[model samples]
Target: QVTFSHCVPTIVQMLLNAKAAQGTDFKGWKITIGGSALTRGLYDQAKARGMNLIAAYGMSETCPLISGAHINDELLKADEDTRSTFHLKAGVPVVLVDAAIQAADGSFLPADGSSQGELVLRAPWLTQGYYNEPEKSEELWADGWLHTGDVAVIDEMANIEIRDRIKDVIKTGGEWLSSLTLEGLISRHEAVRDVAVVGVPDERWGERPFALVVLGEGRELSAAELQAFLEPAVAEGHINKWAIPQQIAVVSEIPKTSVGKLDKKRIRSEIARWQKEGSAEQTSLS
Candidate 1:
């Protein structure tokens, strides 16, 4: 009869793996995931282990409760897979929270699902300003909304799906590729125990995705194998062929921040250094 608990996706992954290893069932435990996006693969894994997961969106500046997934009768009628897709969204704004997307030009975007922009918020509980830091506070509260720095889309259902961090998006051939989306697709591979996808500077394309992967125990995978595995997704129009990483590194572990979020900055820096030093662990899929 335990109620829902809150955690980041990393904690959920660790718990799921540990409990499964110990032959323990989650007993239909409910977990509210925040701090980062929960991948579809992780959701599937948790469901298989008898865990119910819900995704949410917020930050320290907002008293940490901006939006949350809500299940309705219509949603309940959908298949588990379909429900999971909705469950993974950032969801409609919570009570007392006003959320909107702001374009680069400071105009509000429509809740059309396809219009992606920076998520902005205005809630009573949101922090007014940085303590004794007027300049920083002004920037944070610019245009009267708390900037979230998260690129997101709001569907007709008012479900807000975070596409990526504004800084982490990959710009290639004048199109944007979501590193989070790529990581989600890559996580579906059987051998990927842990993964991170980062955009690296490319002289030709402006930027290109690079993957760092950690394989499961007793599992082996190559860059070519991973590239081939993603081909079906490309054909299905889930991702563009150019979105595939031309190079991948099979690593013992992917870097994480002190708070357990993927450390993309560090990952990018490591890749740059590795490329300069010519690491033997790096593989060329192209």
Candidate 2:
């Protein structure tokens, strides 16, 4: 009986599974996925199960509607795969909004599409600053652009592909690894129902990617199995070897925020505590 809804991928997954188990299907329900990056695995799954999954992106500061997926008439009759690719992106800039990526060197990258940088934006309707937080406000509007903290590549056609958050990018073995991209790739695994990837402190590499995965019902997923599955992609140059997660933890559930986004801040804190405890234990053993 539902026609339209907006929810994160996890909620959509749970809802679709529940309907399937009850011998029913969604009535071509339209779902707009946000709060976190939407993986193609989730998009395909929802489509296969009779749901239209649209990818959208925004933050609380921008009135929350900066971009969304919208296929033009020409692309409407195109193949499902082609259309799905567009639908899986963070989306183009909305009206009256100007989106640009700021390179690490502080240069404005071109829209030719190869560059990946921090997404900075400007819009008339965007909130100028946080309430009563002068220091944070100045930081937010530094250099005359609203820093989104999201790293993305914006194509010439204005197609915006969000790769990762600046703080969440994994720097291991002296190369950058995108946690969001890793999560998307790992989610393609049959046994993976949900996953969260984070950068953990490492003395050798500074920071290494650590993943927490939730397995599908009756699915037995092992670290080796998952790593082996990802090896082919690495060999294919689809991802760097260092991009493969250093550690993968299979957990019963991943924590979520009140608004249903991945609680990565909490995860980082927990990982730090566990690492400290492990170090103490090793010292005792020695």
Which candidate number has the best TM-score? 1
CA lDDT, every model vs. true structure: 0.87, 0.83
Q: Write the per-residue lDDT of candidate 2 for residues 1-286, one digit (tens) a residue.
A: 8889998887887875674555567757898888889987787778777889999999998888899987888779999878888898878888999999898788999987768899999999888998899998987886879999898989877988898888888887787778898888898898888888999888999888888888888899778899999998898787987778758777777878887778889878876776777641111111
Per model, how many backbone clashes are there? Answer: 0, 0
Whole-model lDDT, model 1? 0.87
Candidate 1 pairs with clashing backbones = none
Q: What is the TM-score of each candidate against the true structure?
A: 0.94, 0.91
Candidate 1 per-residue lDDT, tens place, 7-82, comes to 9999987876573455776776899999988988888888887889999988999888888998899999999878
**What is the TM-score (0 to 1) of candidate 2?**
0.91
